[model samples]
Target: MGEKLKLYGFNNLTKALSFNIYDVCYAKTAREQKDYIAYIDEQYNSERLTNILTTLTDMIGAKVLNIARQDYDPQGASVTILIAEGSMLPAGETQLAHLDKSHVTVHTYPEYHPETCLATFRVDIDVATCGEITPLSTLDYLIRSFDSDIITMDYRVRGFTRDMNGRKLFLDHKVNSIQDYIEPELLRRYDAVDINVYDANIFHTKMMLKEVDLQNYLFKTDVYELPPKTRLEIMNNLRREMIEIFSGRNIY
Candidate 1:
C-alpha cells in the first residue's frame, strides 16, 4: 500500500507511535533540532518513542523539532499540502471556497456624508468597459458640447479656501506646513479667486459656477444637454488632477 498517512504535531506523533496507530511517522525536514530535544524532554510517556522518531526523521530527511501548542490554535496554524511535482492548490482558493454564497447589500450609516450616493455592483465579467472610453475622448466630448464661458474646466490642487471678502481662509487636513515654493504670486491669485483649503490630501479641485448668470449662459449655449458620459469625464479629470498633485515628488 502507498503509505496511508496523516500529518500531526510531536505530541500526536508520540501518541500514534506509542499506540501503534500507523506503520510509519513523518515530519518536516526543515524543523529545528533543539525543538525535537525539547519535545522529547517534555513527554515522559514517550521516552521509548524517541529512537523511532529519530529514525523516521532520518528516513524522511526531516528534522525532529518541538512545536508550541499555540501553533495549532484556530488563528495560529496554516496548513498547505503539495499534491504532486507541478500541481498544487490555487492561491486564495481555500478561503474563497469556505465563504457563504449569499447576496448582501451593505448600506452606508447616516453619520457619513448624507448627500453622497454610492453603490458597488459585483459582476463576474471577463473584461472592463472603462478601457473603451478614454479620459481624453471624454474630455473632448465635454469641451465640444459646453460653451467656454459657461463651463470652464481646469485642474488644480484642492487646498485652502477663502471667505467672500478674501480675508478668512481654511486649510486642507494633510498640508503639514506652509513652504516658500508656494509662491507669494500664487497666494495673491488664490486671494483673488477666493480659494479655500478643505483637504490637504485631496489634490484636485473642481469649481462649478452654480450662479444664475452662469446657468443662463449654459442654457443659451445648448451645452447643458450633454450626456452622462461627458459629465463623468469632467469629474474624472478632477480626480486625476488630485491624484497627480498628491503623489507629486515635490514636498513644498
Candidate 2:
C-alpha cells in the first residue's frame, strides 16, 4: 500500500456506487408466475436485505448509525442503513443530520409478463460514503449475493478534500474504470462494457450473462419436460428479454 496522504480535515469527497441486477426466469402458467414473484419477495425480504447491508457496512469498516426497513404489502422490500467512518458521532446530533450523506439502500421489484410467460426480479442498491472508506470493495459480494442475469453499475466521486497543505483532491484513489475493481473470475462469467468519464470521476459498467442454461431459467419445470421446439422458443424468449434489458430498448 502507498503511504497514506494526510488530509487537512475529514475527506469531503463523496463516493457513491449505484447498481441494479435483473434475474430472469420462465414460469409457464399463471400459477407458476405468481409463485415466482412470491418466491422473490420472500427470499429478499427486508430482514434479509438488512443483513446484506449490515455485512456490507462491516466489509467497508463502517459503523451503522441507524437503519430503516420496510416490506411492501403486495411485494418487494426496501432497506436503508446510515453509516459513519468509525465510532465517531457528534453528541446530540440527529442520526440523519449527522450521517445523511453516508448510507446504503436496497429496493426490490418483482414483475411478470403474462403474455410471454417471463418473470423477472430486479434489485437496486446504492452505497455512498464520504471518508476514507469506499463502496467499490463490496461489489463482488453484492453481485454474488443475487442471481444476476444482467447488471448495470454507476460509480461517481463528488466534491473534493484538501491535503495537509490545502491542495484539493477530487479523488483519493486511482480508478480508470469500474471493471478494474471487479474480480477477474467474475468478469469472465459475463460480457461487460464500460462507459467512463475520467475527468469527472464517474464510471459505468454493464454486464450480461454470456451463457444461459435451460434448467437454470426454468421455474417448477424441467428441460426434459419441454418439447424440443418449445425448449427452443423458451430459450429464445429468455435471451431476447435479457438482451432488451441489457440494451435498454425494445427489440422487434
Candidate 3:
C-alpha cells in the first residue's frame, strides 16, 4: 500500500455506496408466481438480512452498535445497522450492531406482473461511512450475497478532509471507476457500463448479465415443461424486463 496520507486531524471525508440489485424470474402460472414470491420472502427474511449486514460490518473492520430489523406484514423485510470504526462486541454481549458514523441498511421488494407471471425480486442496499474505511470495500461481497441478475451501483465521496499542512482533500484514494473495485472474474460474467463524473467525485456502474440461461431465469418450471415456441417467447420477455430495469425505462 502507498504511504498513508498525513492528515492534520481526523479524516472527515465520507464515502457512501448505494446499490440496486434485481433478480428477474419468470413464473409460468399464477400459482408459480405466488410460490416464487413466498420463496423470496422466506429466503431473505429479517434475520437473514441482519446476518448479512453483520458480516459486512466485520469485513470492513467496523463494529455494530445498534441493529433494528422488522419483517413486513405482506412480503418484505428491512434491516438497519449502525456501525463504527472499532472492535466488535463481546461474544456473549448482544446489542446494537453499529456505530454513530457508519451504518448499513437493506430493504427488499418482491412484485409480479398483474397480467403475466413475470416476478422480480429487488434489493436496495446502502452503506455509508465516515473516516478511513470505505463502503467500496464490501462491493463484491454484497453483489454475490443476493440473487443479482442486474445491478446498479452509485459511489460518491462527500465533503473534504484536511492534510498535514491543512490542505483540503476531496478524495483520499484513487478511483477512476467503480469497476476498479470489482474483481475481474466477477466482471467477466456481465456486460458493464460506467458513467462517471470525475470532477464531482461521483461514479456509477451498471451491469447486466451478458448471457441469460432460460433455466436460470425460470422459477418452479423446467425448460422441458414449455413447448419450444413458448419457451422462446418467455425467454424474450424476461430479457426485455431485465433490459428495461437496467435502462430504467420502458422499451417494450
Score each candidate by Cα lDDT. Answer: 0.22, 0.91, 0.88
Candidate 2 per-residue lDDT over residues 1-252, each given as its tens digit: 156779996778899999899999999999999999999899999999999999999999998889999999899999999898764665555443354369999999999999999999999999998888889999899999995999999999999999999999999988888888889999899999999998999999999999899999999998999899999999999999999999889985
Q: Count the backbone clashes (under 3 Å) in each candidate.
A: 14, 0, 12
The weakest ten consecutive residues by lDDT in model 2 span 91-100
What overall lDDT, based on C-alpha atoms, would model 1 receive against the true structure?
Answer: 0.22
lDDT value, residue 222 of candidate 1: 35
User: Any idea what lDDT model 2 has?
Assistant: 0.91
Predicted candidate 1 versus true structure: per-residue lDDT over 1-252, tens digit per residue: 133322221111100000000000111122322233233223212222233333333332333223111122111111111111111213455521211111111111111111211111111101001101111112222222222111212222322334334532322112321212133433232211222233532122222222223222221123356576754553444334323333333332
lDDT of 3 by residue, 1-252 (tens): 157888996778898999999998888788999899999999999999999999998898888889999999789999999888864344566664433467899999999996656999999999998878887878789889984999999999999999988889999999999898888999888889999999999999999998888999888778998899999898888888999999989998
TM-scores of the candidates in the order shown: 0.14, 0.95, 0.93
Q: Report how far residue 229 has shifted in candidate 3, in Å.
A: 0.6
For model 3, where is the 10-residue window of minimal lDDT?
91-100
Candidate scoring better on lDDT of 2 and 3: 2
Where does candidate 3 stray beyond 4 Å? 87-100
TM-score of 3: 0.93
